[model samples]
Target: MAIPKYHELRISALRLLSDGRSMKLRDFLEPLANEFKLTDEEINEMYPSGNGHIFYDRISWALSYLNMAGLLDKPARGIYKISKKGVTMFNSETPEYINEFVDKEVAKRDKIKKNKNPEIKIIDLNDRQTPQEGLYTSFNNIRNSIYEEILTTILTKTPAAFEKLVVMLLQKMGYGGEIKNSGVVTKQSNDGGIDGIIKEDILGFGRINIQAKRYRLDIAVGREEIQRFVGALAVAQSNKGVFITTSYFSKGAIEYVENLFGNTTVVLIDGKNLASYIYDYGLGMQVEQTIEIKKMDTDFWDSMANQ
Candidate 1:
């Protein structure tokens, strides 16, 4: 069976977690996988392009999501019990108890947990204008926030969700890219490496091939992976590649790219850089404010003086 969406997986976990018993992520996920009829092979097919532990991270995300949605209260790494919300959610006798409950029933959660009266931020009406520059500033700020969210999401999200986000972002950036289900394995991966591909430009015009490595910590994409990516570029008869990751590259990997820049013009974006770019571009985020500025036409002014 095809990989389930992240939300779907979360809902499944929630329904099971709805029971009074404390459960582990694996406990809820494995049986849910069975109920969903996903074989190990099928399940393995869900990680993002370059990640190896897609399932494990995704399970983590499911648990985190339930906790945020006010359903399950996790006491530790592997243990979870139904919250007041969860227990009530389980008692529903409707056809669509899960999705419906989260949507209409669960109200928007407060950003911060507090029992005191909430303090709202007040903007100076005079300073906060909807002019051109103001608008641009607001828009950029919101976009950056979303990029941060997406990066954070990918850091612990399902491979399926990561892939969807990659596709969406690439498309927004006008990259002629495709997310092939290579089961998140790489040719350089003596164990398992590489992820998705982004063909940004046409062959002659130049193409940007992407290697997105979603990591949890500082893992250097060393000479081996860089070398393999180079080989892949050669196979495709292309000259440019991007090695992106949610971690730092080893010194060897950095030096290797420096050595090869004359040829492939490879670009490396570690997790921090990747997150910043997404923020700057406003991929999955919404625009907040718009601003405009006006200046006199210098040429016209000059002509008037001459006249």
Candidate 2:
């Protein structure tokens, strides 16, 4: 099932904590996941940032909002319990009361700020996000879901296929002059750590060395692997290389490339970045739909004001 929205999570959390017993964050995750009827695959689903599970992240946000609104309290690290106010509202069968209480609290806080500093503008805390901010957040969530799907599909392909895909993506980004002569995958026997190569022009004045690593998502590409690719580049006398991996690179590997000082140029594309590029270049993806968000034309309105 799709993850629940923040309000839904908030209500769920209050129901779970209504017993007045504290619960660890980890303990709360599974019950919530089960309550939502999330399958194992859905439970393991990650945020596009690769930072945490999507369900867990949303629950955490819900907890944060509730705590700020005084509906929940953290008695200790990683532990959360319902506040007296939280229990009262949960027992009253009026979920909307929590919202009203939060709004009243915000107004009280704003009034205090205004009284303390007469010249200071008191912003309405209850109206935190503008319409534009809400729209952008929704757009980003949709975009991230697409990126995650792209990565999952790519992981199922063979290494050779992944290499070809990297080449195709680069071509779509305008790497080579034409599609027919843009790039080619090398024979395995003589590849020398290079999976493919892309010519920058018809005359081949510049070329980009490509090394595509179809790695396990949990593992990382280290500096040693990068060093091997660098050796291969040195053998070919090429100063430009692109190392694309379906996993992340270690800090050491990233630092090594940054310190090159123009000796050689290596562009690293991890799984997250590769998905971003694929989406940006419209490679292997179609236009699902278009959303247009329009704003007022201030210039036109100002011209009308002059009349």
Candidate 3:
């Protein structure tokens, strides 16, 4: 079954705490998984950031929202119990009604804070996405825009520049050891299908051949082109190759590489993936700003309380 939304988990959380038992955040995982009948895979599914399980993150957000709405009480660090308001709301309100109430309550608190501190920005909680989800969505949208810009910029550069860029990207990806001149872009003329090469070691025993294509967005690298590259690898007597393009590969091209039998291994990086790699490796890009998201240290608070 699909994981329940954070708002959907609100009533269930209240129901769990209705008996006046204090529960830790971890205590909710099994009961909530059982309540939703989530499969093992679903329970273990991770957020795109890979920091935590998506299900667990959503449950934490649900509890936080409930606390913000005065529906739950945190009597101790990392511990939660349904308050009188929460029990009353759970018994009397539908899920949708409770969600709307939470939104209104949060907005009211924001209004009160805004009256005291004009610098505090208010958020619109009407959207189904939680604040964290909204932040990630915004981040992805910005990254996609930058990816398009990177492709457009690369398409305008000369073929040699594109080859050099690919070589630099591979080096940034740790293709070569901390040795200078480990990666080299071959000359355009008299060069085989390979555009660049990276020495994987100091002794130049292992190498990764590169074939970079500065193709138009509408063009696709086809099976014939891949076969030609394989033939070129055979001539070079090298089995490892990377074919990067400012376009995509045809289905036949991908299938041909996938079904290849031998020691030869070719990795394909299309325009989208190429741009993503460039971004990830911080090639041809600089950090304009960094935002840090901070959270409460509940364990530290618990330690202080014990003292």
Go through the candidates in order and give the clash count of each.
14, 0, 0
Q: What residue pairs clash in candidate 3, if any at all? A: none
For model 2, name the residue pairs that clash: none
RMSD of each: 16.4, 13.2, 20.8
Q: What is the C-alpha lDDT of each candidate?
A: 0.62, 0.81, 0.88
The digit string of per-residue lDDT tens for model 3 on 183-301 reads 99998896798899999888887889999999998799999999999999999999999999999999999999999999999999999899999999999899865768988999888
Model 1 per-residue lDDT tens digits across residues 1-307: 7666665676667667655778876676578778789788766664443434565566676666567677788565457887987777667544266665554322343233112114322223367566665656555544444544566666767654654555455555656644333122233433222345554444435455656777764456778888898887777676877777777788898898888745677888876677776666786556544434578999888888453
Point out the worst 10-residue segment of candidate 1 by lDDT. 113-122
Where is model 1 more than 4 Å wrong at Cα? 1-148, 177-194, 198-206, 288-307
Identify the leading candidate in terms of lDDT.
3
Provide the lDDT at 103 for model 1. 46
Ranked by lDDT, the better of candidates 2 and 3 is: 3
lDDT for 307 in candidate 1 is: 33
